[model samples]
Target: MTTTPRIAIIGAGPAGLLCARVLQLRGIEVTVYDADTAVDSRDPGGTLDLHADSGQIALEDAGLLAAFSELARPEGQAKSRLDQHGTVLSSFVPEEGDLAAPEIDRGQLRIMLDQHVRPATVRWGHKLLSATSLGGGQHRVEFANGHSATVDLLIGADGAWSRVRPLLSEAVPQYSGVSFLDVRFDEVDRRHPGIAALVGDGHVFANDGDGRAIIAQRNSEGRVRGYLGLRTELDWAASAGVDLADTASVRRYLLAEYAGWAPELLPLITDSDGEYVNRPIHTLPAPLTWRHRPGVTLIGDAAHLMSPFGGFGANLAMLDGAELARAIAEEPSTDAAITRYESVMLPRSGELAVQANQAIARFFAPGQAPAPDHEAEHRRYQEGAAAYRR
Candidate 1:
């Protein structure tokens, strides 16, 4: 467009922050609104491997790639496949200088992006309440903090339960019947040598095709994150009379489900250093696309939420933000830019979403045949998108 537009991004996540940063670099002014009261108002989760193509490219665009590289752990590319008995079935140890995809804490990446953005770029604690269209490619957003703004373009970088998405599509995230209880071990090499040995440099995923699995990922500073996956209903904990708020109760329930698992691996359930969080996997329909509503669009999970089995969520979200920002800076109109962004983003995220569905089914299928080699199949899944190599 010939005239500069008032752009508002609703979210402070990878998609929103990266979009705002790239927009500023392109000489476009934008504002990001988030519900967070402060930066540290979160308990950081585990580390994730960002790919060369999608995530790295976005960080490069924002000029934070070198800094990200400094904080990244390249050796974290090493991964292993194991059985319930804790036998290391197979492993992939990254070669020297192999920087295909390196791991970093999710909190670190978010903080880096937050720090690089211009001051006052993000309006924190502004929980989005609703978006009312002004017609003709414009919208007025209302926040729960008694704030409001009308902008030429409104971008929904918000996550799975985005309020902005109601204007575009009727799709809601559906439960995938897989739930994860997140556990962590801290001061590990010293306090928890056994768990550290099992995790090694990267990840150890143990599955015996019995509809349950454990994924252990090595984080920086001798910390480890484990996801105890169970193929059960969303309300399984409640139905089993396990009060999640009670740590001992949660442990008892999980340990019972894993009765036959290797005694050595049981530490993942009982010996965690702290809190146990239950995250139920959910996804929007694959190939989720809207009818090109003018002046408004979505990015990241708000646009194409999928199962996290293939490590696509954060990577896709960053790519979406970067590409959408570029489109807005180049296209002639808000509608045109949105159209351009959705055209490419939809098909790509859709493909990955389908692959994620297959992965979940293969692992969670009842008495299904043993899934293929873990790292090798993961490489196949990342072939065109997030694939990494030396």
Candidate 2:
């Protein structure tokens, strides 16, 4: 009888959960650790448009494609571009049967993946505090709650601030010089018809010549998730007295900044439902690569964290999980699996990271328009999406 390997996966996010699911299918014993107390401890944020090549393919590999299909919103694939004055610049609605990419709420995707994995596979409230090599192809992981576990293989899917990364590389994520003030409007269609019309069915991306802009998307339950982006220094936000936790204060600050902009864009800021979330964009250095170490590896944000400008972070993470799982299942030895996974993933993620950096530089630069040439930008996005699919 072949001895199954004992694997430890950090984080219960999509990458970690999907990795655990695939490994369990291969009869490997896996334990997933997450900091949250429960599956639904905190809201997992907004919706995601899972591209056919990356996110969708990863789900198919894990045997969750059908589950993802059931939860995906096809009608939410539409996109609209506008200026701050509310004039529609361009729009695209994929024809039926065009499975280019479909939108799924982040919460729904989580639930779908959660149901497919075995219960108790994930130990919640297990905040990872540190990890140390035990020598001879084993490692010890310490948790914040005075608990620890030893495993033969450790997979770090813990995301941007991962503890597992230091074991393999000395790199850290740096700010992208852009900050987003996230706002939301509930029951937008019913309560705020004008704003709802501005957003339409899918996403509304609008920008002005100035350094300020907005990207709003129609979320599940008639909620509109909007991001008011600004190109400013990292300390600029802190010095402005903009209370990130207070919605009213954020609204006031936004209005004051965009005082001369059109009123149509103001409602997205003023009529928000929840506290503003101040997201300071960060990314790993371009072409980030690490030396491979035996018995340890990384996936998802722990590997290549980049700006959302290219909208590939989650999709790439899911793909990394699937690829890593395949490597381990097919390899004859643990060391071989880690070696193959790193060899392929490093170059692939590095390419995407470079593209993400270019996108950020162009989109958020001063005096630049968000996706200046709509047709050209769409074509570029489609080409990248196609390459990933192929």
Best model per TM-score? 1
* Candidate 1 off by > 4 Å: 367-390
Tens-digit per-residue lDDT, 1-390, candidate 2: 135677899988889988888887776768999999988889688888787767877887899988888778777778887777778877887666655567888888877777878888999999999989988778999999999988889999999999999999999999888888888788888888988988788888877766778988888888888898888888775699866666677777788888877887888888877778888888988788877777899999999999886677888888888888887888988888898888888898899889887887776665645444533544554566567656
Error of 2 at 144 (Å): 1.1
TM-score of every model versus the real structure: 0.95, 0.94
Local distance difference test scores for all models: 0.87, 0.82
Give candidate 1's whole-model lDDT. 0.87
For model 2 the local lDDT of residue 257 reads: 85
> Tens digit of lDDT per residue, candidate 1, span 238-299?
89999999999999888889989998788888899988899999999997777888889999
Model 2 TM-score, all chains together: 0.94
Clashing pairs in 1: none
